[model samples]
Target: MWYFLMSDAFTFGAFLISYGTIRFSVNHWADPNQVFNAFPFAGHANLPLAFVSLMTFILIFSSVTMVLAVHEGHKMNRKGVEKYMILTIIGGLAFLGCQAWEWTHMITGDHTVLVDGVLQTMGTTVTNNPWGVAADPGAITAALQKTPDANLAAIVHSLGHGGTADAHATLGRDQMISTIQAANLHVTTPGPIAFGGYFFGITGFHGFHVFSGVVINVIMYLKTKFGHFDQRGHYEMIEKAGLYWHFVDLVWVFVFLCFYLV
Candidate 1:
């Protein structure tokens, strides 16, 4: 297990270091604040670090529950172990749900902006961004012109412009940029795609770890249900799982700092 952990650590370390190198090497990268300011049901409102912070809280609290389970294990308190383990599993699942929502929001690129009276959806691709310097005002306007008024108006209202789709359907280029920035949706002209790539890779890797930890915890819970741990005369399995869960939670702190807070 130690060897496996060391190998995995090396892998994550390499990925993170590479990300940092490329991110800093670039002249302009997307700001974490602008990139991750959306929250669930907030509709692109500026809730900087709020959702991720909640996720961090959930994982950290799960780590605490895991520790308590381990403590119960040391005491050979089967019921206590089972209870805390269940709590830990729930926390893990919640975190996964949050990640799913975040990924969906990112990929769907449903963010809309009025570019010359045309409502255009903002999205990210492997090589381009509709919200960055590469954004073509003409194309955006043309696309939005085809978009449904209901869709365009919803976005405009969300930005607090108070105009219905028909009332304020189009915006000048400068006004569009200003509206996006004012809503904390700022992006640079030459945004780095590498930043998005690395962000997804590292976070996805860490998320996989969390998922595995949850699976392991569930298996251990089932085993405990069957009296496996009590019959074994030790709950060392719980401790082992605890170590992995804690490591996962710890790694997320760094990931959060690098990809979100930084």
Candidate 2:
């Protein structure tokens, strides 16, 4: 915190300045509501946004458990540490699971009650949806809309932004690059540089930290039971892990703000 507040003005300040500058610059950036428009089981729930929000909540809950685990460890309460540690593990695992589901839905695509925003037609397409609704050609056609021309350029353009009539709703080449990568993640996998840029850059890095914290807590759990820290002998491990856990949660909070909420 001190480093950011005073020490490295050029390094940290440069980053903060850059982020703010870009944010200010995107006057026509995609609308969060429109970009995340989705349809879930109940018929096109706003899911992407919902998942991000849920992930945020899950991380926060995990933080609570992590803190409790550390507090108990400090008091030399092995059983208490064990309990809170278990809760922390469960929360971490749950977050990972949710992230897995979120990534899966993105690549496969999803259907929604939305239809061109204004049209609101119940369109469906295998190429478009994560679920690939019933094989009704009408629904698929209304959504997929393959290019009329057989040329690569046509296909590319049709999918590319500002393409032809057949490709209006399609993602452009540059935008579509990450589509495939999104399908293969364990938790928010990297999808091309754009998707991967944020995926691996932010979430992946955060996950790595989580992985390390889990390792520490697991050690703490075992030693705790074996009498190494029984009766609250060694609470330092928990405190250290808590610090790392808090950092992880803190990063997610920022991620939710910059990547999702904002």
TM-scores for all candidates: the values are 0.78, 0.59
Q: What value does the lDDT take at residue 94 in candidate 2?
A: 76
Off by over 4 Å in 1: 111-120, 125-190
Q: Give candidate 1's TM-score.
A: 0.78
Supply every candidate's count of residue pairs whose N, Cα or C atoms clash at under 3 angstroms.
Answer: 5, 12
lDDT of each: 0.77, 0.53
Best by TM-score: 1
Instruction: Supply candidate 2's per-residue lDDT for 54.
Output: 70
lDDT string for model 1 (55-174, tens) is: 999999999999999999999999999999999999999999999988777776645544444555555545544444444555654554465645555555556556554554466434
The stretch of ten residues in a row with the least summed lDDT in candidate 1 is: 181-190
- Model 2 agreement with the true structure over 146-240: per-residue lDDT tens digits: 32222222323323234553453255533332432232211111111232233334555566667776777777778777777554546786777
